[model samples]
Target: MKMIIATLAAVVLMTTSTVAFAEQFEVINTEGSSVPGCQVTNSCFIPHTLTISVGDEVIWKNADVATHTVTSGTQRGGPDGVFNVSPFFPEDAFSHIFDEPGEYPYYCLVHPWMKGLVIVQDAMADDDNAETTPPPDDGDQKSQMDEQRATPTYDAEHFVTTWIISTPGESIIIPTGELTGTYSVDWGDGTITTEAGNAIHEYDDAGNYTVQVYGDFTSIRLGGDPTNAVKLHSIDQWGMIQWTTMESAFRGASNMVYGATDVPDLSNVTDMSHMFAHAHSFNGDISTWDVSSITDMSSMFASATSFNQPLESWNISSVTAANGMFRGASLFNQPIDSWNTSSFMDTSFMFLDAVSFNQPLDSWDVSSVTEMSYMFTHATSFNQPLDSWDVSSVISTSSMFWFAESFNQPLDSWDVSSVIDMERMFESAHSFDQDLSEWHIIPDGT
Candidate 1:
């Protein structure tokens, strides 16, 4: 089952500027070493070394849990005047351009042993002719070499794209060359629209935002502060896409995304435990997402107070844990009777303080669940049918219905033989007057 065994570690660095570039090279810091070509014990920067033209750019992306730097120079020599990175966290990246022809060796200040090299070459040296015509205009004027390099190279997996904040609360997006399709845009402020000439948008407040674009697109990276958007609107094909398909794509966003109309496909997602833990403004229509691949749904909607959408059609057969799935969700009372809970092993605090939940779950198969402690603590409106549930596998039912004022269901037939704790099972259940003469209780560790 999908589980969040460790928290995602990173330090996000914000930027207020953008730069144009030519060919772009990527170096990812994954696991303990760089990937795609880099290895540890010897060469740490995948490719270890690289050769590029004077105008090319190289981007270093952090894919590990720890921080990494791309300081220019070796450990003993210290940092050079070339480049250096501020503490960048997981999924963070930094780029630099080479304009001079020379050999530059770089290393990571955090991990002194990690190193890399970049060799810059003169543009004219690439031509076969010893003395090329007019020295091939170099940025000073338009030349034949410039036209040759203009031919765009598109990736089968990712379409070339770029975006920038046009002004306060607005952004200008450009999907250049080869990629053609009417796309939909989610401004990340409870608003969505279609892409026109140069996709533009405005936001309500001034803060960091992630603009999501979908349609004939495979990869999306919209990073900017859309504080200067206009009120123009249009529609396109956005129903076929699911925005969270990529890995850890929207980890800690608060009000950045809202409404069900903007979420894309989720058939391939595995870990979504804290996807929206503290997102207090998300009440979107994501009931149609395929959640069969998910295993860890703990705290998925913990503090999302405005969410009350229907999720009865979701297939949760592979789920194994839902520790705090609805801890503080105060307005969720949807019918989830059709959920497949046979593989659930942990439901601790699943509905800790959900004051408005009272759905029927009589047909649920919960034979594999072992922890139901505080499952319905403080759930004032929950009084549903759960008599047919096979909870013989549960080990902790302490405070299971504590403070559940309206829960008066008859549980005399339940096999509580395996429960090791039953303290405060019905502590403040003012409405519970059912007979418990047939209960088979036991203490912790016999």
Candidate 2:
């Protein structure tokens, strides 16, 4: 299923930013490492000792629940000037470029027991047996003495991808079988006009390159390698790509964030599920995006911890599924009560764990919604008047405000005639002591 979506997106898929010559590697601060047990098991940083070639990039991903740092030096000696990452939270990442060759040791300053080492080797050494030549000017410039690197074969399995150009003479396979519509590819170095299948150009030098494709297509897999983005940095263009296939285009590109002033054309788009889910550092001002045609918005900004833009001008009249749209978006707190949701439904998990969200929602027309499960669970700051909302159409309000520590409002006028399940709807909501003596519950069996 992933490959199919990737292939469809391959038609207009273009990786914008230029990557480095050396390959990228990931080091994870493994799950359940915040406690003391991980240090005893030597499982603090997965592969506590990582060996890589010079010029390679190492991305440290925090998969643990607690915040951590990737600081250089030992516990006693303190931090060396190697590479130090400030406090980064779970699902967030920090990358460092390694240019010099050496044995660099690092540890978490907050947790001294968590230790790791990076061994950088000079991969392009001037050997006695190999001959070297100047890099050809046709492609990216190759580093001196980088001659013995083997050519990378293109994989047919991956139909859609944002490439990280490592070695020269590598083949970039574009599925000519798909892409019936017109599109163009700017392969960073230059543009490729011809729609060739596998006979794509190979660089004469051993450096790096990037690409951007724009055309009409079915769908594109959300960018990055599922959960992590290697070289995805920016979206410089949206081109003339005409389609609703931009679903999950930048789902997990943690590196693509901020200073994004370019507003994309979304007139042709409809479904936008998981569009920016887990894009940790993205805080681009897209408050004016034309999202009127959009319908499904499930998980669009889920886990996008840095996104906090105004959405008051958005026309959500056509939207339906809004479940998990702002789940885990801790910094998002904007007034969007003015959005028209007359045709909307399914508001489950809309603000789950959105800790900083505290806005007025009494004006929202939620009369058409059917499922309102977990709508404000863990939204610690959400406390507003919801008695004005007409929830007669809602069938499930399960876990709606669970753990919302600050929510305390009147709900005497709410209609629960159609509700079937209200299980744990107000559990752990510390300040919620609303009287519901006038309300009546309708069981499913009835």
Candidate 3:
């Protein structure tokens, strides 16, 4: 009995390690979990089964109205003692790292009908084979720094984001994250630190210096704080760090930051809300970014005055909340009609004060949108067709087209019966004269 108990304890032990090349995956606990039909179709968790690498992390966002638990083990087998999130409310999130290689099943305590499985495979097996490979000639081989820059950084080997700081008294502060892993920071001024908890490293003299950070991280938020964002000169190398959220990463960065322009591995990122808010003068080459995994892009480029990059290739199929995505971007006028918004629900303040945005968005799938309050307020140059929208799921359209001077599109074919708030929906000096007498308001609407 003692040996059996010890074996069970070992299986549930938490082993945390940072890997640079690991990926991030997200699983939604889907809406309407309080009912019984979700289990019949195996749709409690979207993509009921997920497979990931050992070092990869799985973030679970609770979309159901009721609070649910993501406890390891089935309702019949009881708790396996692997991991458990007691009670997470609607819109809350819980994440777990799969350090061991095996199949781990998790179920909801509140609702036994909900179940999901995760298969973790060891990603280090390929690294062993890479060691047996022959090396290149001396002339063809690059330096250690060059090799690090040319490849993705991860915990499997070792690499970090190489930052170039040229100003004296300038500091870089590192923020804390959810998971605990070993982090090393090389200040490049003979100071090497292993702790990455709100680490504020200051340069005493003005000179070109390289700062490298190696480790596993999930959230590197407001990387350079709002007050010290100007001090951040450049991120010479953005290593392959499996980040889950980049929200407010550069909240108030100035134009001096000329890096972070490379196409990063963003397969696991979910929340990008306020990522580049107030980042004036930032016009980088990020036209090829894969944005398929992003769910929250609220205020992503808000107040970014000089950003006009081509973003027609971004896969935004998974986005759900895009509130204020391009708000106050005075000079941005990119064509993004080909993007997918089938999963979008909340797009409030999406284009508020975006004066130069006049593109074709007739092909967008906004049938899933709910709250469109202030979506196009002050967007003076927008004129498009939105007559085929299925607005039966929307509850609020307050100030939706307020102050949009050039919009005179036909929206008479919309179903406004579900909208409870339509105050000032088209209130402005606008040319909108469409007949809305056929539209019916909800019972509780004004």
Candidate 4:
């Protein structure tokens, strides 16, 4: 009888020990348990409070149907970078071992009202481990606040001083100020020249010819042989041209700045996108100004019917898009082989109907481009070497080579792995006969 009692006592003791050691909980998205402020709909966590010892592991099994995150902080404040466990799917379990004794307040990221707390108590208080330096200063640390409320520098109220001077019969464009780099001038008459101080030219007839300058000059004025005809043209109404300082100040003056002979200070401009988009008469020397801060160059020279200038010295690394940039610009064909196009993403409709752009772009880094639809459509004179371009990231090639009658380069070396939409890609491309049997086409274009 005594032996039987001992065996029964041993079994009961073993069951109690197993229950005490295993600290487990479940997170449920159900009605709250009768706690004071915890409600049914908002109380995401099943048991909102838990107590555990140091060196003990806690397992949280998600019983909710939706995903939940065990982030550390209150709903009003942001995350505290503590133990953040997220994406706990239905029936998924997450475990974490407590190494220190402290009160850890946690809340769900998705459901902020579903708050919980884990109170960890030391198994044994060691005096030597308790005495340490003070915690870090919260005030000294950098706050991870949103930066959208910062002060803006570029307001539309400020006006940039610009003047227009036209020379009726003079055929000479002279560089006056202390010129540093080499200045290139496109004489609008299909003639390009490089000079230091004074650039002289002879026009075949007396017609309005826009001369483009490509050098650095500050505080210089342009005049037409001491004639009143070289006065400031109409300043026009200040429209949506928002800028802090105009680098290409008169870029918005379409075709009017063509008569101006002086170059403005373009050293402080940041946004040069669409600056000379429709400036049909502006063939000035702007090749020497600093353009490092310029971000958007989308359609900078689009529809400029008579612009064919050399832009090889330009550093376009900071530009992000060139969409419809040179579209309908019939006379632009200069050597832009040295331009850095690594940052451009959207080149869609960039060279649409540009019939005279056939420069060699074999060395341009177009690896980041994702859209090339309508890029070379209607560009009849583009037959340069583009076989070595890395087109793995391009998604849409629809109507890319449409109506390109002069493009016959072998594109067998390009990686067209990521292209999804290729509808009408080579339609009307009478000159494209290269074999494309190795292209990996996606089934559903999503």
Candidate 5:
């Protein structure tokens, strides 16, 4: 009979121990009861520092009839909107699960003096059953909050479109739609559809127009159509493909298009070369482009007459070759001092007919240059300092400053001993006044 009593007492003790270990933590007032307010003697239940294993949960019960709150520290503050609570009220409870191992401090929003600490131990200590309880609504609320912090707004009044054409003239409204259906011509009176399925617009006068295209339109090849001379205005936030070399790659003629008169939103473009070649009237600001992914800018603004945007801020430091990059451009006068030309090899005629460029270029590292013939022949006003340039690897200087009519600077420091040609180095330069006593040998043996 005594043994039976002892066995029953042991079983009861074990059951009580199991129940206590199952609950991670419980917060009650000083009285130690499950009631809202603490004991009369101790009004507050202070759990200053708590050390729990990963996946452990902590529950805060409103021991006092007054309202209270639980707010995590700034470092691990969960969501921006739900970071605070009100007065300590009755039956108010807040709970949080510690899934990550870290030191998290929290406090009551209503009473700054009330604080708590939670230290979550690493899960590796107890490998088994470390999974935390998922939130009641899963993670839907957190996901929505993250997305709301990301999207940008749009503007309509500041948007404009400018087009460049092959022929000299005509006016027309470009219809916006998926690249399908018969092409139509808008002459301000009525719309006329063509049998060739090509939208034909006529502009008898010479001016610019701001065209608007609404909705989702894709596969658009701007300035590729032979009879089209329109340049889409600002790209704003839209995605568009401006130019191409292949005729069949777009809906218009490949070679007939001349220029791009609009500022394309190249925020989405990975390449920007040859997008404005043969364009004569494209003069817009492109100094703020993010061209980090562009690998080929071969003839980007070649022959563009009015393109004078500064590109000194671009990360063209990775460009390896700049062959004919700005061959016939006439109005590009921005400084190229910020360019990293260490990887560049081909700079032949880079500024061939660029007449408006007279900035100082003494800092350019041309150590890898092998050709300089005709590079500055027609550049009339470009007589800056070229004394410090290393032309040791140069093989040709034939017509370098031939037609440069305003070149009167000294070239005594230039090493032309290894140059194979100096044919017309001073052809039409009527303003030649600098002494050539230091010149190794005149091409005509003068």
Candidate 6:
């Protein structure tokens, strides 16, 4: 009985030791280490590599002043799942548990060059089996992994296409399987006279269609004036182009000439928001556009990388929504003080990732904005007069200036009395210094 009891005691000690050993994976940043390779000084993990076992958790503690993220693998790196830890603040820690056996690599979406790999090994697999499997083929594995991570690809041809419209009162059938074509309109009865042409095409078909009104620039008349003037009076009578097909139509005739100077005529356009949001090569001047009827300007130029038209002259006094309006527009740098955004609520990423904008927005009224999280994040050089703006209504300022490297303006005038989460608000802002002595923090006694 005594021998059996001693054996059981020994087994309990061994089990405890194993449990403690299993939870031993830890990630640390080396002090004063700025080297750019694996095992930089005291840091165990580099940009894209970490090794651990099943049931083990890896904790990432930010030691440097610069913010870092652990986003899923991108184009340069390998497969990384949806788990992301971004804008990690100094002393802030994030832990992820590895339950399965696989190699997971991640990168910093904000800083793409930073990479890290997490290898989860099976507790039961022998060391010999692990060594013999050979590191997964980087070429084939990357392709397969990318396929799994691919977002739905949109076909432009399926939505927008060309067509021909016959005169004032004729039903035109669109050619089958043709995604696009030119539509020529000729006054059928001649009573309307092809010389005094002002005909509209009605596309009852459900898909996106690029309707091109072909006419002599010197032949058409609007008010009996012999000027090649085109007018789309109403939204109902005007052609409707959905977002899905807009890309294809824009690309097909992306370089097509329209106006007198080969410019596209958008003077009568009421809703200009989201018109060219995802258009890659839509580099036309719509500075004189009448956008007085537009209310939502959200995501209007979100990812338009090459658009640099001067739209400061546009009449956007009626625009109420500017959410994500300039999210990823890296080239546009025109003044937008003409916009009337009194009704905006969510300005979360209004200028996030916009690297070239450095204008003064101190005169605008942002009293109604609630979410300012990441509003100016990654806007490298956007440091100017924003001191007059009201931030009393803001709630989430979590990542408001996470990676704004060149933002060093004084924000003492901001009323953050209503803000809740201030975590990582100034993280990775390599050049940020604002006095927060006036900010109303919750009383320590209360």
Model 5: lowest-lDDT 10 consecutive positions: 1-10
The digit string of per-residue lDDT tens for model 2 on 1-446 reads 00000111111111211134467788989987877878887789988999998867777778888866676765434455455544445776756656679998988755668998989998764475246543364144232212212222232221223343335665444333232355555565665564432225555533224455644333444453553343344443443445454567678876453322345567877878888888775666678778888998889999987678788999878899899999999889889999898887999999999998999999999999999999999999998888999999999999999999999999988889999899999999999988998898755627
Q: Residue by residue across 266-376, what tens digits does model 1's lDDT show?
A: 665566776556544344566777788888898788876656778999899999988889888888888898899888999999999999999998988889999999999
Clashes of each: 21, 3, 4, 10, 29, 14
RMSD each, Å: 20.6, 13.4, 22.3, 28.8, 23.8, 22.8
lDDT of 4 by residue, 1-446 (tens): 00101110001111121222335444443433223354444365656777877745555656655655566555433344345443334555555555468987777654556788778887754487566543354223212111211222222322122222323454443424343345555665788777665556766653334444554322121222323222222222232322233323334344232212233334455555565655544454556655666766666777766567677888888777878878877777888878899998988988998999999988989999998999999999999889889998999889999999999988888888799888999999999999987776668764
The deviation in Å at residue 27 for candidate 1 is 54
Q: Tell me, by lDDT, which candidate is best.
A: 3
TM-score of each model, in listed order:
0.49, 0.60, 0.61, 0.46, 0.45, 0.44
Candidate 5 per-residue lDDT over residues 181-267, each given as its tens digit: 432222322333342223446655433332333232222344444344323322323324332221112122222221222344444
lDDT of 3 by residue, 1-446 (tens): 00100111112211222244557788988999778889888899976899999868787888888866676776544455576554456776656656679999988755778999999988765664665533444324323313322422334322233333445676777665554266777777899888745567888865444566667655566634676664444444566666677888777765323344355667888888887788764556577788888989999999876567788898889899999999998767889988888998998999899998998888888899999999989999988888877888898999999999999987878998889988999999378888888888766674
Model 4 TM-score, all chains together: 0.46
Which pairs of residues clash in candidate 4, taking residues 3 or more apart in a chain or in different chains? 211-283, 212-283, 212-284, 212-285, 213-284, 213-285, 213-286, 214-285, 214-286, 214-287
The CA lDDT at 299 in model 5 is: 57
Q: For residue 75, what is the lDDT in candidate 6?
A: 26
From the highest TM-score down, the ranking of the candidates is 3, 2, 1, 4, 5, 6
The lDDT of each candidate is: 0.61, 0.68, 0.71, 0.58, 0.50, 0.51
Model 3 Cα RMSD, 1 decimal: 22.3
Question: Candidate 6's error at 188, in angstroms?
Answer: 18
